[model samples]
Target: MASATLFHDVQQILTAEHPDPFRVLGMHTVSLGGELRLVVRTFQPGATAVSVTDEEGAEVAVMECGHEAGFFEAILPRGTSAFPYQLQVTWPEAGEPALMGDAFAFGPQIGEFDLYLMAEGTHLRLWDVLGAHPMTIDGVQGVHFGVWAPGARRVSVVGEFNLWDGRRHPMRLHPAQGVWEIFIPGVQDESLYRYEILPHQGSAFLKSDPLAFTAEVRPATASKVADLTKYEWNDAEWMRSRQEGDWCNRPMSIYEVHPGSWKRVPGEDDRPLTWREMAVDLVDYVADMGFTHVEFLPVMEHPYDPSWGYQVTGYFAPTSRFGGPDDFRYLVDALHQRGIGVILDWVPAHFPKDAFALRRFDGSALYEHADPRQGEHPEWGTLIFNFGRNEVRNFLISNALFWLDEYHADGLRVDAVASMLYLDYSRGPGQWVPNQYGGRENLEAVAFLQQLNTTVRDRHPGALMIAEESTAWPGVTQLAHLGGLGFHLKWNMGWMHDNLSFMSEQAIHRKYHFNLLTFSLMYAFSEKYVLPLSHDEVVHLKGSLMGKMPGDAWQKAANLRLMLGMMWGHPGKKLLFMGGEIGQWGEWNENRSLDWHLLADPLNAGVQRWMRDLNALYKREPAFWETDFSHEGFEWVDFRDVEQSVLSFVRRGGESGHELLFVCNFTPVPRYAYHVGAPSAGRWREVLNSDAEPYGGSNVGNGGVTETVPLAVHGREQALPLTLPPLGILILQRED
Candidate 1:
């Protein structure tokens, strides 16, 4: 299959890396045929996929790439871009496609060189921030509106702007380059507009610059209007939750929740919660659960229909999904009441259709950028704010602070940190640009993130800032002073990835990869981390955590126990999505609420009980908390005959704290008197058991045996013999 709609004459973002044969990234011209039709694409390589969108004021186009399109062959034609959209190659057997840095787009253009690697940069200035209106006091006219398309034949800046007609709106076209540029000196405060690209150079289509700061609807769509702003938040002075000391990267038994679907009782009228109503109910639940914190998917104002709340239309307003802006404030306050911090999943990475929001809140390049080459997120058609512009920087920075300070959120889990770091984060080479200074171009985004962390921390000491970074962009979770991104905590994505991979494999093969269980301990070397069973795993393609396991009900139970045991014992913060505790049976649907009824059954109920006990044990045991123990606490006692499916480890508390040893049998048969190495010689007590019949596990073992059992070993102190059951976790404590 080939790309039916082809692109031509593509160009690249100029940089100093290569003076000649400049690599081509994107094109300067996009041809959206008459009726201003929308173009879309979906990048689905699995049963489920990540489909990007496009939104510019009144004009919009969204299309999903089908899973049937074959792995890389499924380009849903996202939206028209100004560059040569690279061809995505698919590999079904590999599970996913590799980033083949090749240039492919809508037009006939070739990249002159490799670009994603070249480090190009520039000094950040004031114009990049959002909501920044130029001060024309006394006559110093700063940056103004422009009717420009350097790559087009003719253009005009139109909106609730300089009149509807093309009157004072004519943009000048540089014939030599077949483009246009016109600046309106007097335009500044309170404005919204978009560039209308004319059919130039043998083209018969109208285009919307993906980088337009303000967009307007030109008919033939469900929405078309210039957006302005009107919002009033009273929580600006709220102090964020603690970030350091007692609260710094502690056990994060996060109750991952999607506000829209958390309590939605299937047929009920969409789980309605009045601000005060939810506050009263939810705060009680968090405190009772023993979880340290709670994470809410993008709570900032967004279009309500979106299930995951990923498509944000209002960056500053809290979603009216459940209630109003102040209602969200009440929700945060409720969390604080329970001694639990709330984490807001921020979407600074993109925005949806809310012309009344960011669509050119001011004049040209007010909230975004003037050129698609700089302001567009190619994959997610949403208008990507120009992180390089001063005003745009301020807009995003201030937006971040607004949630932290006003809403009193303890922290923010910045979405898509990978996108913010790389110039061509997901693009094939030539699609990105750097400043005049020569660096990996999105330098402004990085700097702003640093500033955001620093500022948030300075304002509130214990303010925890976490990063959802998938890419190993060195120092992403490091402190700003160390020249890193300054996030207090980062998602241990490697663990999630490897663990999921291991869980998906048959138990017979899992033993061979025992290293995956303990290797992520390496994450402790950099910034603090949080092991999150995020919504990503269970909802779509990857399948629910339980569904990924390979075995019968009993084996599945054991598998879960093993995974949960490792998660709890691991050295890092911890979190769990809403229904994961009760063993949700269905896939995570963005539309429906969590399947709360699953808890009604004895089997699922058992999983929930085990989770509670784990949390209790984690808190009661000092080995689970405190930083000094990281280096000395966790050690794999045995992985011998990993192929047979057996693994064991002992976690010793630091500063002379209590010690606990955990052993597991991944195989299907029971093993008697398993030899596990222990650090001290003394009585060992069976403190916890995952084989409890209540949790859907067989009662194949004895627990609470408070008796002395010691063995001598040459290394440190000794090893001990303990009974083991297949697919079960046994916790023994040293009893002197």
Candidate 2:
């Protein structure tokens, strides 16, 4: 038998007699009679021909997708909704059209889902790209709807399509699988949809589906409702460009911002600014900062404040709070035009109940798990996914690919990964489940993560993928073959917590916590890391970064400057949440604009100037850019000074050697003749000085120095000396 072809277009099918309309990712015939359904499939691109078999060795439903050009539509089984299935591509080749991959079971569900819920309403909107191709709704009828109520005897799916009605669309349950579904052709494309889940024992529950892409609400944590197909995308090059791997392994400096807080534009004040308003100002500001990237807090959609967008419901849609989907795409395009990449904060770990996309979808387990342990996240009080369920896995993975494929996102920072990987990551042992082996390992979750990274990387080689896993998990940024969980970078949480704590305490406290300051460097020693003064630190405990400072107002500002200087001194890449750059005095509030008025203040202006100068020096200094990934090129020159509240270090590049000596003084008292350490004795010149009067520092710098003086310690070129003032940082470069 000739291997089944995975795909053949209507043209190919009409012309060739036995032409397979779909490229056979794999193919296998199985006996679908009893508890088992097996099938085999063919492979075209990264597809590993799958063969599902019964106990009698007969094939059931084979899952596969090929890596060929022009094979976009997936041929799905009739009458069954595609909820969960694994889409695996070779890590470096996954993308639209053709990128070889695999699909596995997410329970009995078949297709991937797109849920990101909103706050309320019975109407739900579902959309997929293929939905636009044919302009017809086929096989979408009878899309099941049910609610999971171990406590419920019945569950129904209702929506706005039925006059805010759900009782009319009741879903039946699969006794063995514990799933509920409905065959609904009426809930077609672009329709506002929601499920009126009838709990068996309680009154009919009103909830949002967890699988909505564009919801009617925001933050996705409130009741989920969506107006699907409302936004129109204009950039085709974005999708094409993403598949090229044009944005990987590069130095990434992300400006984390909230759109609503970033700025407001005309026609959008009483009405919040649209994506266009954001694109105009934000693109220019980020470009001016020399930052190569911008990261948005779960901008897709959510309802309430989980503070910093850790809780998400809408997976496919951009937050209505920001703008429509196409409008968001335009913003991404604008960033791309400015040579800045866009990275979204993706939350796949859990979703809030306010989301209606999959809220009791089909009256049983649809987007999430049917069981309590599998569906609910104990620690976060959210809904967790069953990775072992193929349909659910596909739903998540497909969305990852969709953003890169449709929206032009250059990178993604997966939030709360630690929660996703471990059984009881934040909770105690009693909160989660363990693998068959009885250890802490959650094999299914691990496998899902592996597949996610692999598939995402394969699909968008140039786009970046990052993890926010706080646990010292091994191999977070390595290729799978190297036994690593693949990711480009991990947020240096340990450093942020330790450094912020050390800086927050009075100067006396910092001296005793030297190890805390000294040890963070080690975390950077492995894997590419970013020293993020991320939004995480400033908003929650005790207020803004400056608010955490121990001294008087002047001292507070000085220490804040010192902390920033230390950030520039460190070896890893750097990131600063918005407003931090200009010294916003208050904690982040989603409701208000960053206090741009503060920039008008002299002291704050100086802070801004210092930031600019520092960045200029950082960019110009060859030592900061070269061999930043390796350990040998970077070394801590010193950390012992306490009286003057100073810390100094050298950022060295590889053998193409450029030694950058950084001297920082935290105290407000003026200090002179600061002796900074260096590796060689050369005519040292001041490449840049943050203490220059233009940057709000004391007018006490010569602008340049030429000295090749000899040593107090000759082994590494003895003494490299300089002068410093309160809240000062000096960057010195070796003479050529």
Q: For this target, which candidate reaches the highest lDDT against the unseen true structure? A: 2
Please count the clashing residue pairs in each candidate, in the order shown. 59, 125
The whole-model lDDT of each prediction reads 0.58, 0.61
Candidate 1 lDDT (Cα, 0 to 1): 0.58
lDDT of 2 by residue, 607-636 (tens): 777777667666666577566667776676
Ten contiguous residues minimizing lDDT sum, candidate 2:
115-124
RMSD of 1: 18.8
**Which residue runs of candidate 2 sit more than 4 Å off their true CA positions?**
1-191, 195-211, 218-249, 264-271, 305-308, 369-374, 620-622, 640-646, 654-656
Off by over 4 Å in 1: 1-244, 270-275, 353-356, 360-363, 434-441, 706-716
